[model samples]
Target chain A: MTEARDHVVPRRLIEKPAGGARLRNLGQYLFLAPALVFMLLTMVYPVLSNLRMSVYDVNVATFLSNSAPFVGLDNYVKVVSDPAFQNAFRLSVYFTIGSLVFQFTIGFALALLFNRSFPGNGLLRALMLLGWMLPTVVSASIFRWMFDGGNGIINFLFESLGLLDAPRHWLIEPNTALIGTIVANIWVGIPFNMILLLPGLQSIPDSLYEAASIDGATPWQSFRRVTLPLMRPVALSVLLLGFIYTFKVFDIVYVMTRGGPVNATTVLPIYVYQLAFNFFRFGDGAAAAVLLLLPLSIVAVGYLWLSQHEESSS
Target chain B: MNASRSNRRPGWGWTVLSTIIVIGYLFPVYWMAATSLKTNAAVYASPPQIVPWPPIFKAYVDAVINNPLALRSILNSAIVGTGTMLLTLVLASPAAYALARLNLRGATLFMLLLLITQLLPAIIIATPLFVLFSRIELVNSYPALILADTTFTLPFAVIVLRPFFLTVPTELEAAAKIDGCNQFSAFWRVILPLVQPGLITVAVFAFLMGWGEFLFAITLTTNETIQPATAALNKFIGQYGTQWNNLMALSTTVALPIIIVFASLQRYIVGGLTAGSVKQ
Candidate 1:
């Protein structure tokens, strides 16, 4: 019976040859065809077009027409040298770093707090996710109202608590405008960080903590030694993803301040939008976009390399 | 006995601390609903009322009756969102299956391409898309927004769904093939059913992507009638910034569906997001 079964298995496997392999290969490619087509049309083509348009001076008049004056890196020169672009670059760096630091710290705290089993923990954690789940525009609008000079609850609360001397225009003043947007962004970002980090925290074995405690180590000491080292990869991913997401933030900045109060909050994405749509300078807009893409591409490549290396090592 | 008592005391303290933090975090959302129920004068009152003494729904009434455009925009959002979800699922499912199941050459390259696409900011693509849509006269149209949203959703759906496909055992497909099913038939009849949960998760994500889409909505649509709720509400900011009550009411309206969807599908959404990252 065993010999008969082996013969049957070998015959079945040997039945298909090169033709069947080729046919299966064709079928696999066919399955991939639709998604590949859509990606090329929507992503690949548009990105290449942006690069092409950056070289040419395409404005409102020539935008519709096929022919535009070719300016060959002049737009790049113009964008890089532009004062607004430089300020926006500075602000982008500030905003990304600020949001990442606050979001990660607070999010990691929340993750640690919720790591243990407790009554109502699951429900509370789910409720906290509401901030991340809300529409960006809705959140922006709510924050806009909350930060309103006279009517905002923020001022009212601050004044009542003696935290502020007066009702400040949070979204309008140049100095406070960027800070206000960053505050709202941090609120939106914390839940994301927590959700990602919670799993990492949970995956750390309790035995390690008990082992540390048995050695007379305190809670903080265990966290420093056992938790932080184990959580490194997760935290790195969270920070990297947070940097990428926050660096390209447009909706909150656009809706909250519109990069206003003298362009204090004009990050890179907002700058690109203003140049392209508001000013009708498509070439410069595309050039600014290409500039933005360069750093992000580097980060993305790094992320890919790290993840691949991680998989191979594991 | 003393050690156990000490543990219980800290647990209560932690719970109280967590409640306070959550309340503080959700204050803005709570304030949104409260503001919608307040009179315009009361909203600007120096000492804001913790609870509206005499809560009113007048703002909601006004938003519903006076602002017909808001309703229309919501309808437009639904249409676009549904279209994006359907199209994204159709395209992403087969691709995910191929990537997860097939021994296709250059599959790694394709996965890398999808990851790179995520890093491409919307503003980068928005410029050329606007130009292209204008050339094709698709501006101010639902299809334009849907297609743009698909660009964001498709890559995400493929990435998330691919892992779920990988979890399905290969023997299941081989068994289906033994029963005289071809590759496509086996995928459709055997594998698709197994990954239904993943499909639903991706669909929910795709729909939310379309619903909450703001950048493309504001950029691609010139006509107010064609704009989604996000863009429509944004117009109110410029035109009626003083109407805080009405504006908050409209904001609540826009946020309600997302809240409902998230509350119901929190498990799937969280699972899908973490599964994509943690597995890799």
Candidate 2:
């Protein structure tokens, strides 16, 4: 990928340019050069610089103390030891797992549901996407209000129906708070998953299904044997994409809980912000931020490796 | 006939299931709008008012006129989002064209690089970028906000634009070149115009990212004047916790534009994103 991007693909890009196409050359470069520079400056530079910053001492106190030491890898060690950090780390895993499973299951189910022709299908698809397109703050805000201990929709409905004897602490209770945010995240993420899987469903030939049914394969058996394997690439991409987006989710969690109720819902991004801006410990925050990046970088690298493997075998 | 009848059963099951699924999915958004128009008293009234009667626009009014932050944040968001779309299009379209059409030897590599850049979650770079921006005195600047935030949306533009650009054959460009146009002019005149849908998708992605940016906006900009609507919305959940009525009203307002745009352009977005996603 880097080779193709960096210095070895211009000849290929021509796509059979006729002999001496001057306008073609200029127009193509005209389109490509500026974007390359832009990515280098904004996207690539900060990432490289941050990787460097991860190694240095960057706290305000350290700036105050000329003697403040640069301890390589120590901040990573410290972040690993802190329980709050540990909890945040654990939460990221749970959040990623819970969201991926729910989003995929529900999203795939919806995709299959929408796959067949039905009445009001168009309206349903549009309405289903409402949660996905509505900004996180907007959706989370509604749910946050709904989850309010006193007047929240959950409590109000349950209490009035006489389901619960008392108002439940939906957002404050340790167990419920994480679940609340996850539910909100799932609601927001499903549309994306469904949309991705829909295309995969479309790509499958209906003839395959007809043949399967003719052979006495139930719909369940056909799905397991045929659709599941065929949609693997689409399914994997959605899972990874969901993880990439959800792992760094800020607006929803922050808007809903601010990682509160004894820090029950704090994820890594919140930790990064709190440390840098709130605690005024830039160095510590830098360290925490690096810690967050480490796990994500590993995941990114692993996915990239798998993709390369797939490309090579194909 | 039995086989046909049995096949038909699953279709009916799917219809029933989809209706139930959609209702289950839309419940929260439904609740949000429903609760927003209710009076504070009615909002909290026991047994809940799922169907708010004598609905009030009081929350909308509060969010728009009463809450000082809402207006400010929306303005700030507009400026940042517009800036991102301009920057990405002005810069990325050409590069995407080049990657798709030029003689650059590493074109596939460029495409791959863009894809790889997207693999990591933004949290990985948010803090370090935060500090770096602050050091350059660009933390509070709109330009920095737009440029830094484009990382979230621009790669998809590059990837999405590629296939579209790739579909435009070299024959048109060759003809344009023969007619004395420069390569850049040919792209603008011949190839670019053909890829307008890709450009629209790119613009939408850029706008959404800039519109929805929260972490960086909240972290980078301290002043209310510069904060986006999302940053300001976060302010509603302060030390005392949520101010639900005002928050709901603002949420309704935040969602209204997307709902409007989505109502018109959902097919494009779904088609565009699906194409981009399934390409791999």
Candidate 3:
């Protein structure tokens, strides 16, 4: 009897003309067609072209020419072996990891602070976002001036606070240029982390905390057992997104140091920019870009997985 | 009752701490504005002037009059920003609506594609885009920057708007369909009005992306006349001797619109970020 009912339901559902259903499906696809076409032309084509151009021996002369020769794996070998690429790869790793650690820790503290109801909490949190909202160039320029060796406010403040014996060249010095850029990046990223995590903090029901309190749990215990596990998904998303964002940062380093002081701050993006634009070596630049994509793609994939899992679990 | 009272009255300490933190965070922005009004000597003083005593408007005047490119760059930024916002909305809204509402095949795949697109860094595509745009004779045009900026904003717009569309109940569209309205009109009359805030959020974000865009703006537009403010300000880095005061003036002008937008749309911006990331 159940099988017969299922058959009847199918028959009734299929009573509409197949042509009409097909036409409706086509119309639905038409809704997606414009965006898909645009992405294809702009995003997909450029990525594929980058890959193609990486294998060719293209420079200023051959870049505009149709006769650029194909050199299989040559550009990749050259970029990978170049000392500048090695230094940049090392610096990029340090910069991204350093920025992420400081940004996350400070942002988490701020998030915890702002999680509670206070008189001026809302206003303070809004003001905190100014760092994140300001244009990258503006922030970079501000930091450049603030970190200037001669007349920088930072040195002035440090001297006033008795933390320094003399003014230091933050951007021009080889040892401190990368660190200066990293400090600026950390400031820029903290608000992003806090804003994302604040919602996660809010989502935890008060009942959980109440229950914890009734059980005579300490505040630290409650945070460890209740908040940490609940906030894990949000935390993961923030870290992964932050990793990708910070890893590909160009403008901050560009404006502040220009990946300079003898390539102290030459992260991968700046490295690729210098190769492609400044030096006019399109093939090597494209090769380095592909290299840059490898690590970011891993993080991106992880983020996509975590976000999908969060959606499904919720 | 006593504990709750104490908690509620834990006032001055928290207020002072929070105020200090806020001031620390906003100090750089304050310095940017203050430095712009300082005289050259005061700006470079041994103890950097905390506030420009008897604040001067010389740098502002110099930024406006001496720097012709500053005004031109701002105009170009507006043009590019507006263009990108409009293009992104037109393309993303329909797609986002379909993905949210229609139970279509391959919807998951489309979403996955969009997610992956966000991972592709702008520099990876800069080389090829330069080649292609120059080939098509669009190297220095507004459309070139607008189109490139859309590449960054389109996925973001879709991601932000999809959740909003999901919130709009299907029953409203179904009821409209039951009446005389066709599918298009049902969407137009029933759904569009409800998602106005989402549209505005996406528009503001897209505009900001275009305005603040640096990599593509620098890569594509070699002409100062067509360059945006971000790229133009980059030129003043080592130029005009030290010119720190003038640079700060230009930076302040560039940062003003962003500050205004954030102030007015704080709610939507925060909502969009949270909804796009955490909720998803």
Candidate 4:
């Protein structure tokens, strides 16, 4: 099932060497300066600026003038009070959780299936990555068309299969619009999950599985007892990374519904985009963005700690 | 383990089942391509013409030849993609090399920063960047979009390339230094050529990121003249909500380059991905 050489490039490249004191050259700081400066201007400054904008009263008129007065917590208060904010907050939860559950399960299933020896395993796996490789806009557009109410293929299939008496417009109804976006996201995400999980699956020793079988364990029993426990670390990383990716989804929802049919699909990112760009409520948007970033920041910190832990322990 | 695994051949049943699964999963891709080829009427038909019986170029014609914005958006994407790729390499390679070899005191901390930056939501950065760009009158310009795109790509490029740099034995650089090459020249003359494959991989990844970028392009550049294919496709979907054929055609056009690149560079790209994620 696996390639003769699973890695096409340097095996030595990825293996982290133990921390050792090496030649220290301050001139190397010159090498680092350009990227450091660029990141400071781009990443560090923008994040801090976002924080600043959230606290200040930044409207369109004041945004450029650099004269917005400090209004600590007011923007956050208003953003929280807005009915739309609450709605988007709830939807964001549903969207993120909904996407994570389905994509992870389907992806894991595919990974396990592909782990066993079979013909064309490599080709099929590569083909599966098509969904992940394509740009989000492309995937979202295809879904938008396929989910069209009147003449969409999904409606045609549902009616033929006797699942529906008539075509249900997937994206039009507020109730189902979030589901539509989640479905598309699952397609986009499944490939990624499968790819990551496969390497982890490969890393588990077959001798452990053989021992389980020798002990009269059934395949299901072996999976639960041995595979599941072994897969925990990889699964943790996959889910955390997937959570962050799905939580900040912008292109799929934006292209599919644009938080449409009465704000039905407005996730946090969409909400932030609308508040700032559409409504010209920069301060409130910044506040809302900070709210969105809050959980992600926690998750990011957890992921960092987890990776560092994995590194040191291993 | 290899011999035993290879000897225990799975039945043809497994092959058939997996093939079915692949086809089912890839149905959306097929549908997109098929719809793009169908006539406008065929697109709206109830059964949705599982096969575009007699393919037509009408949608492609309409999408590209008729709608001038399609070509313009594609051109904008190229410029941005190229610009971002070049900038990312120039900035990221040296930094990545430094981290890999220089053993700077703060290298570990800087790497942590890069990883977190890669994970930061684009909207978070876009909000401040939009305000900042408008203030500086950099909004609605190619430089603005390219610069914004780098916020995502620079960290990514650096992360991906550092491993490649580490693979290059430091003795190579030491030998170059012995030959009277300064540190910079030694790195430039000796180490970089060895990591050309990694450089190519990062360039492709960065270009694709730039080409497909949406939020920054849309938020920063309200000018129709400067919008990339992604924003243009979105605009098309909104304006021509009923034009499924044309929409699919445009979507296919936007996605074609990505497909080509992926096809050609599958090995290196896949290797780079696993190295970044799994090895971490």
TM-score for each model? 0.95, 0.90, 0.94, 0.94
Model 3 per-residue lDDT tens digits across residues B48-130: 78978899989989975577898999999999999999999999998999898876788888887777778887998788999
- The regions of model 2 sitting more than 4 angstroms off are A1-30, A61-69, A158-163, A309-314, B1-20, B239-242
lDDT of 2 by residue, B28-143 (tens): 87777787788988876776777889888888887678767678788888899899888878877887777766677667777766876776456546665676676677877788
lDDT of 3 by residue, A1-314 (tens): 12233323333233235534665567678878899999888899999999999999889998887578999999999999999999999999999999999999999989988887668878888889889888899999999999988999999889989999999998999999999999999999999999888988888887788788888888898898888999988888889999998899999999998899999999999999999999999999999999999999998878878877877888
User: What tens digits encode model 2's per-residue C-alpha lDDT throughout A1-314?
Assistant: 12223222243345555654565455456567777777787667766756655566667665333344677887677777889898988888888789889999989988887777656676777678778877788788777877788878777677768898988788889888988899889889999898888878878887788788888898789898888998887688677767777887777887888898888999877777777678766666767766776766676666677677768986
> For this target, which candidate reaches the highest TM-score against the unseen true structure?
1
Q: Which stretches of candidate 3 lie over 4 Å from their true place?
A: A1-19, A311-314, B1-12
Best by DockQ: 1
Which digits, one per residue and each the tens of the lDDT, describe model 4 over residues B53-158? 7899899999877899989999999999999999999999999999988758788888878987877889889989998898789998899999999989988888
True contacts kept of each: 0.62, 0.52, 0.58, 0.62
* DockQ, Cα level, model 1: 0.51
DockQ of each: 0.51, 0.48, 0.47, 0.47
Estimate the lDDT of model 2: 0.75
Model 2 CAPRI quality: acceptable
